[model samples]
Every structure is written in C-alpha cells, then in structure tokens.
Target: MLYYKQLKVLFLLIILKSCFFAICVAKIGFSTKTPYEFIHPPQKNVIEDDWYNAHTDQYTCGAVHVSAVIRHGARNPGESDSKRIANIHMRIKDNIKDGDKFKLLKDWTNQFPVNNNKNLNDAGENEQHHLGQRTARRLKSLFLEEDMSAVQFMVSSAKRTEDSALAFYEGINEEIPSEAPEEFDSEVNDENLRFHTMCQKYINSVENNSTALKEYKVFGSSDLINQVLEKVIAKLGVEKNVLEPADLKTMFVICGSEMAVFKFSPWCDLFDDEDNEIMQYWSDLKKYYKNGPAYRITWEQSCPLVAELFTIMDDVIAVIERTEEDKDTEGYLLGNMMFGHAETLGPLYAALGLFNDTVPLTSKNYHEQKNRLFRTSEILPFSANIMFVLYECEENEELLNDEEEEDDNPDDDYRIQLFVNEQPMLIPGCKNLLCPYTDVREWYSDISDDCHFEYLCDPHKKMHNEL
Candidate 1:
C-alpha cells in the first residue's frame, strides 16, 4: 500500500511537470543574432584559393578584383521599437500578481535609452571589426598592400552604414595599414547602394502603403498571437495579465536586441521554437510585400547596380588587354565595397532571382511553407555580405611565359565566384562553382537592355497590390 501511494504521488508529479510550459531557445531571425557567427562564418570555411588549382589545373588564376555588398552589423532597436519594448516589459512586470517565476524579468532594467536606439552598439562594432579582419585575411592576395588607392568604398548615407564601413576599414587597417592618397566619399548617395530610398515607386507605393502590409498584418493578428500569449503566461507564471499581439512583437524584438548585446536573455525563455517561427514569419511577410517580389518595380531598380557590375567586368577585359602605360589612367579601379541595409539586399536578391517562394507566404499556409527560401535570417542577417570575386586566369603554359611573350591572348578567360556570407554560392546561370565571366554577363544582360531605373520607378505607374 505504501509503494502504491508513492507511485501515485510520482505520477501526479509527472502530470504537473507535463502541464508546465518548458522554455526553448530564442531565435530572433534577421533583426539581430546574425546567422554568420559575427566571429566566424557559420558555414564551412572557403577562405583559401589553393583548392581550385587541383580542380582546374589547366588554368592558373589569381583574384584581381573583389566587389562586396554587405549589410551593417548588429545595432540597437529603433527608437519606436525601443520605446515599445520598455513599455511592454514594464506592463508585464506590473501585472505579476503571484506564482510568477519572472525573477530575472523583474530585476532586469531597461538601461538602453529610448531616443538613442538604432545606432551601432559596442557589440555591433565588434562584429564589423571582426568581419573586416577576416575579410583582410580572406582576400590577402588583393589586400597584399597597405594602399586603399586601388579600392573603391561606398556606403549609404545612414550613420549606421557609414559606421559599419569605417569599422570594416579599421579591421583591414589592422592587417594592412591604410596609406592611400585619397579617401572615398561618405555621402555619394549612390543609387546603387541606396536604391530603395531613391526610387519613387518603392517609396510611395510600398514604403508608405499600410494596405500593402495586409497579409503580414493578418498573420500578426492570427492564432499565433494567442499561441505566443499562452506561452508567455505559462512561462512567466503570471496570475494577472495585460498583453496583446503587438506587445508580444515588442517582447520578441527586445529578446533579439538583448541577445545581440548581452548574448543571452530571460525574455527568450518565454518562447518555444514554434512561437519564434511565428514571430519570424510576421517579419518575413513584411519583407515579401514591401521589398521582395511582390511588386515589379521594387527589384527592377537594381538595374543601376547590375549595369555597373557588368561594366566593371567588361573593364576587366579592357584591363588585361591594355598596355602597361594604361595602368596609371585616371579611372583605373580594382575593388569596390558597398555597405547598405536589409532594404538594399532584398531588392538585389529579387533582381538576381534568388530566394523565391513558389507560392507567396500568407497567414494560412505558415506550416506548409516551413522550408520556403525567402528566409531573411539566412539571407539578410546583420552584416551579411554577397561577395563577387573576379579572377584573371590563363592557360598554365601561357602563364609560364607571360612576360616573355607579347603575343599572349587578349581574349584570356576570366573566372568569377560568388559567395554569400563567405560560403560559395553559384551565379544563377553559371555551369558550376567557378563560372566564366562572359557567361555570367550573358545571364544578366537584361540589366543593361531591359531595366532602366527611371523607367522602372515611374512615379505615375499604377501600383499592383496582389502577390
């Protein structure tokens, strides 16, 4: 009878434990907590160029130019986001009547000032500096010198972007000191980097339109909100409550922000993986409608940058063909570094035909689209970069006698490799990992022939809201 009584008590304890909501990991998506470790490329390392020689022994190659477009590193939440987060946290603290296990939340104080949000935090600076150090080491061949003269660096006018570029440049400076004759401008307002803000159609039709975000809003207000609410109540052990879906979003945002800065947070303990996914979907849907493939003009504005890329590539051919005297020409260039925002990457991805979902992401199909490609965390995470490494190659025999033979082929093949967040990514029309320059050019020819930004962003063009 004593054993039976003990067994019943044990079963009762097990039932109570099952009823408790266990905490899971916190995943903040593209907002912060970049997939790239900020200290390491979370993917396998592909930094060295030596392995390619084994695959393509017929041709000897070296990287002559590298063009990288990168997003800024982790930053503080925006002023509005910051304010909302503080407000929500305060309300939760106030409503804790009894049985609440929110010791950390109760003790946690909002030290981050409301008005000073969205600037680069110390952690953000560290991320950029580390990335720059890695970049200098990765492109050691191109970064062989302490000169920035051969480099072209550009950034959007945002203080955060400029801060990130400076941080990256400082990282490069550590490896190879900067002694360039001239410094690149911080305020070029280059449409290539700041295309979204410059385009009238994108600004008017998408950025300003609340109705365009209807699908995302529907998802935000869907059953997931209740799911998140239930989780928060169970985990917080709250007896009294005053929370809404918007407050939950603010909660998630703070969870991400705190993680980015402090590397951990108690707020994350309130969520399960599925709860986090719902929050991520809410943000992804917004990107899809506003900057992604939803509208035609949005991605087409990338024509300017595309035209510039191919032109620079064509200049590569001209570079090899020209005499040594032309090396000192006024406009001779070797590399370009542009730092922009998530707004920048989304449209560019759309232009390149990357990360497309077969069917649009909506409130109803969240579970079905679990494996969809438009995940911003994977593609547009903080400090994410798209690397365009341009290689000049020649037949092994031709390379052996290049200085002696003036009759070398001017039509020498140039190879191109694309890397996303430092992992090898193939250009859409390329045959393999390393693609011929001409072939890649042919694939994006529409950049020159079809897309003209002025025409694409016609202010008077009627906007379509349907996916």
Candidate 2:
C-alpha cells in the first residue's frame, strides 16, 4: 500500500513538470510580434512617483540625463516575404484539410500588397505611441519646461523609423501636453544609427560573406528542422520538395506579422510549440552570426554608437561631481532619443556583452541552448528600446534601512540604471536596478576609449573621432 501511494505521487509530479515546461518554452517568438505580450507596459508604475517600479528606497535626487536606442515598431513583411505568402496561398487550395480553423486560410487572400513591405501598419504605430506616452509619464521632470531645450531626438533615414519617431513625438505631447519641439534632428545620418552598413569590416566579414551565415544555414538544413518542414508540407497536402526552408520561414514570418496586425492569424496554427522553438532558433542563429557575439566584427562595428553614449555619460558625471561654487552645465542635455532597426540594437547589445550565451550557438547545441539568454523575441521586438537613466543618488537617511546604513558611502553620489524594453536590465556587476556609477563606468570605459570608427572599419585608415 505504501509503495503504490509513492508511485502515484511520482506520476502526478511528472505530469505537473511536463505541463509547466510546456507553458514556459515556445509561445509565439518573433521580432514582428509586440513585446507587450511577453513584457507588459509599466502602466501602474508610470502613475507612481519613484523612477523604479515603486521601489522608493532608491535615493534618486534628480535625473541628470537619459539616452535611449529604440527599434522601429512592427513592420510589414518584406517584398520577398510577400511573394512567399502569395506562393503558399496558391498551393493551399488543392492541399488544405477541411476544418473550422481551415476556413480562414481557404477563403483568405493575402493582405500584403506590393510595395507595402517596409511601412508601419496601424499596430506598429500604436506601439510606439504608447511607448512615448509611458516614457513621458515616467520622466516628467525632463519635459516640464516650455523651452523644449532639455530633449533631443534623431532617427535613421528609413521611412518606418521616421514615422515611428513622429508617432512617439505625438505620444509625448499627449502626456505632457506642453510646447514640445516640432521636429527631431533630421541631419543625423546612417553613420550614427546604421553604422554597420557603412563599416567595411562588418560588410566583408558578416553581411556580404556567403560563409558568414554558415551556422544558421546549417541549422536550417538539420534533420530536426527538416522533419518539422516535412510535417508542415504533409499537413498542407503540398507536394514533397514544394516548400523550401525559406518558404517555411516565410510562413512563420507571415504568421507573426499578421498576428501583430490582426489579433489572430490562421498561419499561426500551422506551427506547434516545437515548431515555434525551431523557428526561433533558426532566426536567432542568423542574428547571432550577422550582428551578435558570434562574429567579432558584428559587435566591434558598433564602436561609434557605444563611444557616443559613454562620452555623453562622462559629461553628465563631470557635472554631478563638481562643487557647488565651480558648477557648470555647458554640454549636458536632459535626454536623447534615437530610432533605428533590429540591426542597430543586436550589435549594440553584443558590444556591451549584455546577453552572451555560455557557448557559441551551433546546430548541434540547438536543444542544449534552449534556455540561452540571447533570445531576441524579448529584446528586439517591435518598439523595443535600450535606455540609460542617470540619476543623482544623494545620500539620504531614507535610502538606507537600518541594515544598509553601516556600509553606506556618502561619496557614492551618482548612480546609473540601464533599461531594456522598459525594464531595468540586470547587469552582472551591478547589485540591482540602480548601481554605482563608477563600477558601471569601469565596464564602459574600455569600449568607449578603444572605438575609432575609421580605424576599426578599415585598418588602413587613420583614426579620427568623426562621432
């Protein structure tokens, strides 16, 4: 009787473990999908006073500066993807199995029109608008002035990014309802935001190199992925070899894109949890080699952007450390916001060593790296951003509880917090959300001092600070 009772308990535990694991891994992972599903907007916190999520222990005297790098909102699939969608649509008629779920796909015409690929759909626009509103609400101190001198903004040349910036601007005024600037900086070019495109080494080593995407390509051709593709074709009743890996990828892409625009998509039903994980790894591998830590040139090319961010921080620190009599505020700006693409944030994250996996990603380690930290669905989704908030952490009795007071240092007057997708990113050296500025600067200094755009991009060129 005791043995039977133990066995029953073990079986129930096993069932519960399986159910929990299923819920954790592989739920709709894609860049086009809104991150709000995975990371909820900080609506409740925005209404509160503290900069953090109601953790009032932070002794933030005032915010000195803020810098953010935001990716454009959800965009339509590219031209090639639209063609793939049409191709799959053409094949579906003779192949699709009849069911209530099949009703949508069978009667569906492709919503994507020619030349509509790069533009922001209505969903994309709304994402950025809310982001802007939230940002403004969270940092009200920066927008209180009528002069509008406190804030600066820039964007990539891409029309989607420009439109995103405009939407963000509109959202900001909705929150502050003040005399905000009518225009963002129109002169900041691709060299500042899309530096990878201009970088010769990045181009030669990753972007244009046929062998650069070897890992991603190899993974796509693996038995695991092939089996998934075979099942997809079988389910659709399409002929064998009719759908290539790229076409299957296009199916996933269309599913994510349509799901972002509309609340639901029939294309999404073609993929199961396992298929979702497989597709995620496939896309992540491409980003890893092309712009992540897999290739040195991938992150190394982001030198200029990193350098620019650190230099601004240095100026703010100088102001913070100055004595009351000798104080000066010549170069300090309250905020800077720049809008770019997925290419912009991926390389920057790598340069900062934010989400590096323990081992380099490979086809053999696909399953092993299932819990890897470099997943982009959470980091690079539509309207995703990486922001640095510098605060003057004046020593206050309120900041230190009885246990913390003994070790507190008055000299630690300034602190910094890095936010990713509107949450404080857990940096290795920092203890919590707000960390010592000096310790954070130590991690930042080497990258900032070493980057010379002309020198790193092309060895033959002389080094100069064009940034």
Candidate 3:
C-alpha cells in the first residue's frame, strides 16, 4: 500500500510540473510574438481640429509673454513600421479563414493610403497652420503691431519639426502678417530637446533596466491579457500557433493611422470595447514604466527643459522690472515656440506630474485600469502643446482708489497660467488654474535644487558611500 501511494504522488508531481511549464510557455510566446500590440499608436491628426475648436480664455489682465512646447504635426509611418503593417495585411488576406474579419481587413487595407517616410503630410501642414492662426488670434493685442523680433523659436533637428515651425509661422502670418518673422534666429538643440539620447543614466535605469520593469513584463502576460488574446484569435479564426497579437495590432495601427489622415477606416470596427481597453492598458504599462510617475528618475530626465523655461521667464521678468524710465530695455519677449517629438514631450509632461494615477499601476491592480490615470491618447496626440501664459493682473486696487499716483508694478502682479492642448490645466497642489508667479517660481526652484545634473544622471554615484 505504501509503495502504491508513493507512485501516485510522483505521478501527480509530474502532471503539475508539466502544466506549469505549459503556462510559462504560453505567457512567453504571447509577449515575444506581439511586441507591437503594447506600443501606443502615433498621434492622430484629428486632435488638431479638436484643439482649434476648444474655446480660448480671454485674459483680463493681458498676457505679456507666451511659451509653447509642441509636438510636431502628423506624419506617415517610417519604412520599417509600414513594411510590418503591409506584411500583416498580406498575411491576413492570404491566410485568414474567417469571412467577416477577412472582409473587414480587406476593405480597410484597400483604402489605407501609403507613405514611405516620416515627413509631414498635407494634414500635418493644416494642423500646424491652425495652431499658429489660433494662438496669434488669442494674443492679438500683444501682436497688434507685428514685430518678429519679440518672438523666439526653438526647433528640433528633424526635418518634420523644421517644416512644422515654418507652417506655424505661415499661419500666424495669415492673421497678423507682419508678426511672423521673415526668418529670425532659430536654435536646433538636440541636447535639450532630445535629452534621452544624452542622458546615459535615464537609458540605464529606465530604457535598458529590464529588472526595473519586471512588473510590466508580468502584467503583459497576465491572465487578463491572455483572455483578450484568445478572444482576438478566435475572432480572426486563426489558430494560436499561426497568429500573434502583433499581427492583429499592426492592422489596428494601420486602421487608426488611415482614419486619422483621411477621417475613416473599416478596420476600426473590428475590435470591441474590451479589446481596445486591453490594448490601451498594454500601452499605458510601457509608458508608465519607461517615463512616468512609476519610475523615480523619469522626472529628473526632463530637468534641463524645466530649467530652461525658468531662465527664459526670469529674463522676461527682469526686463519687465526695469523702470519705465529705462529706454534701453527692449520690450519683454512676447512669445517663444518649441517643437519636438512625443518621446521628449511625454517625459516633460510626466515631470510636471500631469495625469498621474492615485493608485499604483501593478499586475495586482491591472483590473483597475479605468482608475489608472495615464491615458496616452489624450496626452500625446499629434500637435499637442503645453502653453504657459504670463498674465499681468490688475494690481493695488486700494492704492488706485486712494487717488495715489500709483505704486503698482506689473512684475509684482504677474501670474502664470498653464494650458495643455489649448485647454486650461490646474496644477496639483494649487488652488486654481491661474497660479501666482512667485508660487510657480518657488516650485521650480525646489525642482531645480533637487535636479543636480550629475546626481540625476548617475544616481548610484557616491562620494563616501554615505546617504
């Protein structure tokens, strides 16, 4: 009897081990085969139209300075990305057995426009034009007399960004023709705009540190993802061995890009709400781990940008403070424009603590995605912009009422308002959307103190191995 019981126990252990191995394999295969499914879709062109329609706030005190950090306008996919989509489309056409899914993909890919490079498309041109036109109109009082010298522009190294800057200039000229510079000094600094390339610490800790994002990897292969993958596989009538999540998402990417450019795609209807929510969570996971509140160093990566903004604002304030008697002072800078990619823009927004989830994003909390605050589609869409408007509010009403000659200074009354994508944003820990300049300055000063370039770049560095 004892010998028989031992044999049964050994057999049970073997079965359990085999089952565990199979589960591991399935999870591994899911992650390895469907890498693209987790990547967020490129910026949609329609977001530009949305911004144009958003109501602009009329400043009661008047805006003396405007700063805009913007994502470049819409563009086509790169050669490799397009090739992947094309291959997936061809595979679905040749091998997909399901009638509905096959027909849907066929109709969608048939209408999908082709582009082989990342240059700005016609829609991109219109998007940038609209941004400039709308911004110029809002600040029309400041630009009543067109003087390009009052404005400054910083563009990234990419050709698309350069073209975007030019397009925006053209748009401003549409309304205030003389305000747009014929061509002034524009700096192209990849160091400040593309800090990821230069920040070795960020690359090591966030980009290359596989161990740091183990939760993300586990979440990607969780039961929730597996169930969604199974649903997608069944919908397409393809065996698990033959089809992968990456293949399906590539079709989705093409569908979304086509729809954004041309305003419609049949493939958009292929996925139900469940599938979209799962895929969006996947993208959110990557973003959260790579450059968001989840990582301690993510915000530090954007210190240079925050510092530069303060420097510009300080210079402007110094000029404003110069006595009216000082004729040597050139008028304070009215506006400054910057154009860059979402890779940098996303991190900058993260540094500002925008859209942070109250609950931690973990595998255990994956089901609570609705409450997870990071939404890539809403934050990093094409032509997304973060604008800082410096307002000069009415100052010293008591003194004016007392019939005094006036001791009020615009610099003392200056306040800063934050706007994201043409809509006002109320910063965390602040009472209102419009915050006092001193409060903003103090907040940034603290960030600057914490942002020691050497320490941020090399968190592990130690002088005496002391805390």
Candidate 4:
C-alpha cells in the first residue's frame, strides 16, 4: 500500500510539470498568432558576397588573368533612410502600450542606435577585409608572382568604397606582402566608374520620365506593396492612416541596414516570409527603374565602363599572347580589379545581359514573380562582383575539327570564364562557364557597339534626349 501511494504521487508530479510547461509557452506567446514576438534578421540574400572555396580543377587552365567589378561593403543608413527610422522610433515610443509584444518592440527600440550616417561600420570593414583575404587565397599564385604595377586595384572616391578597397588590399598584403601594392588607386567620380552620376542627361531622364517609371509605380501600388505595408504597419503598432509609404519605406531600409550593422535588430522581425517577398519586389522596382532597365539609357550609360572592361581584357590578352611567343615578355597587365557603387554595377550587369528575366517583371505577374530571374538582392547586394577570367588551355583533340587547319591546333586555344558573385555565369553561346576567348571577345564587342558614351550621354546628339 505504501508503494502504491508513492506511484500515485509520481504520476501527479508529472501531470503538474506538463501543465507548468504549457503555461510558460502560453505566456511566452511562441506561436504563429504572435508573429512579431521576435524580430527576424534581415534577408542575407542581398547583404554581401558570400565567401566560397574554389574547386581545385577550376584553375586547371590557370587563372592567368582576372578582373572584377564590385560594390562597397555593408554601410550605415543613408541620410534619408536615417531620418525615417528615427522618426518611426519616436512615434513608436510615444504610442506603445505595456503589452507583451510591445515590451519586446520597446526593448529592441531601446537597443537600436540613433546614428544616421552613410559610412562603413565595423561589420562592413570586416566584409571587405575578408573579401581581400579570400581573393588572396584563391589566386595566391598570381599574387606571389605579380607586383602592384602588374595588378590593377581601382576604387571610386567615395569614403566607404575607398575604405573597402584598402581593406581588401590589406587582406591580400597580409597574406603575401611580396606582390601587394603599397597603396591602392582611387578616382573621384571617374567617368568609367561612375558614368551615370556624371551624366546629367541620364539622371534627368530617370528622375523626370513618367513613361520610364510606369513599372515602378505599378509595382509600388500593387496588392503586393499595399498588403505588406498594411501588415507591417499593424505589426509595428502604427496606424496606416498616420504613416505614409515614404515613411514606411524609410523604416524598411533602416530595418535592413540595422540588421547588417547590429547583426540582429528587432526591425528585421517586423516582416514575415510573404511580407519579405513584397519588400523584395518593392526594392527590385526601385533598383530597376533607377539603375536598371527602366530607362532607355540604362544599358547605354554603362557602355563606357564596358569599354574600359574590354580594354583591360584586351591589354591582358596582348600581354598573354606576347608571353606565349617570347615567354620573357613582361606581363604588365595580368589582372584588373575594380570597386564601385551599385549605380555602376547594376546597369553594367544589365548591359552585359545578365540576370535578366525572360518574362518582363510586372505587377500582373506577381504570382509568377517567384520564377523570374532578375532579383536585385541576388545580383546587386553589398560587395557584389562580376569576374572575368582569361585562361589558356590545350584544346581537346577529339572534340576538334576533323579537317586539318593551321589555326585549328588544339594546343593554341585560349579560354575565358565569367563569374558573378563567385558563381559561373553562362553565356548565351558559350559552352558552360568556359568559352573560346574569340567568342567571348565577339560577344563583348557587340555589347561595346551599343554602349557608346558619346551617343548615350551627349545631350547634343539626336537620340533619346528630352532635356
């Protein structure tokens, strides 16, 4: 009878323990109904260039030459974005209640810093430093062999970009000081690096052209933006009638920037998956209309830089061809690396016909948007880059022409491979990432024809100039 009594007590204790656990969960509000209880970190899809290992076989033809155009690292919110976030915080503090969710929001709001300047924070600097280190490790051979003069490192005059370039250079030199340059080169709004900024016509067209920005308006007004905004505003405990889209957009930008700077911010958790999709689409609209395919001059504005890229590649090839003949020929131009803004990188990608969606992105296709290829976060994220690799290889004999020809020699072929954010980009006519240098050159040659600076930027020219 004593043993039976002890067993009953044990069972009773278990039941009480389960009840207590249920109570804690209920109080914690850890359920879908309480979606905003914890803020999610900003989407990392557009944050930075993720570091990756290059396959050993990737350099088989040898990374004899390489070039890159990259965006700056993570940064603090810009002037406009900063003001919006601050204003929203003030509003929240004034109106917040003493509820469970409100307390969490209040805690995060307290932690969020008030500084609203556009500069590289600690995390941003680290991103650039790590990019340099990764580049050094990947091309250790090239770094060891080439000096600063042989390798080109160029940056825009912006403070963050310059800092990022220096950080990258520091990473390379730290690993192998022998080939590192004592100082990196920076240019102030160089036409090649920042052509759009310098071109008044392009800027005016983007800002004032209603026809060009029709799609931006469509996307911004779609159910996507409205529903998401309504949901986000409610979650933030703000009235939609009280807050406007511009005000809300500032909050959105701040949320992403805060997540990047602080590693995690309550602002990030304001949006769920569907909300994030809407936000992403909204961002894509701005990027597209501002620097992408929204305007006619978008691709043409990037032509000057494309020309520069071609020149860099041709110069490197000239050296390679000479080295092949005389082996002792000075390889003065082995690699070229550039750091620029999204203003430069976005249109440049569009000019190159990369990341283009087969079906034009539109509000009517919101349901099919998921299948579209032109995602801004994927293509124009911080520290994003596109690399062109020039290589020489012994051609495959069996895969070669059956008819003997003097230039058909398998051993004399040169190859090129292109990578965007460390992933291979497939050219329309090229075989995989690796394609014949001649074919790649021809493709770029065609691009260069359409991207003439004088034709696109010259207001005096009889082209698409309304101003």
Please give the RMSD to the true structure for each candidate, in Å: 8.3, 8.6, 13.7, 10.5
- Candidate 1 residue runs with Cα over 4 Å from true position: 1-58, 98-100, 178-187, 238-241, 324-331, 397-412, 448-451, 462-466
Arranged by TM-score with the best first, the candidates are 2, 1, 4, 3
Across 1-467, the per-residue lDDT of candidate 3 in tens digits comes to 23323444553453365457445221111111111111222232423222212212322355778888887877766666678877766665666786664564554444323564577766677778877877887777776685877788888888888788888877877867763346745789775677777677777777888876776677667777777768766777766765565655565565555444554344544555556666666666776777666765666677877777777887777787784569787787778888887767777887777887777677667666665557665666667778888766654444454445543445446678788877778876677777777778887676654666666677465222100
- Could you tell me which 10 consecutive residues in candidate 4 have the lowest summed lDDT? 28-37
TM-score of model number 2: 0.85
- The TM-score between candidate 1 and the true structure equals 0.84
- List ranges where model 2 is wrong by over 4 Å: 1-25, 31-38, 41-45, 52-60, 94-101, 179-186, 319-323, 326-331, 397-411, 459-467
Judging by TM-score, tell me the better candidate of 1 and 3. 1
TM-score for each of the candidates: 0.84, 0.85, 0.79, 0.80
* Tens-digit per-residue lDDT, 100-132, candidate 2: 556767766667665875898777898888888
The true-structure Cα RMSD of candidate 4 reads: 10.5
- Which one wins by TM-score: 1 or 4? 1
Tell me how many clashing residue pairs each candidate has: 0, 0, 0, 2
Worst 10 residues of 2 by lDDT: 47-56
Scored by lDDT, model 1 comes in at 0.71
Q: Candidate 1 at residue 268, lDDT?
A: 67
| Candidate 3 residue spans exceeding 4 A from truth | 1-60, 98-101, 107-117, 179-181, 396-411, 449-455, 459-467
Clashing pairs in 1: none
lDDT, candidate 4, 383-439, per-residue tens: 777888767665444544668433554323567778777667887677667777777
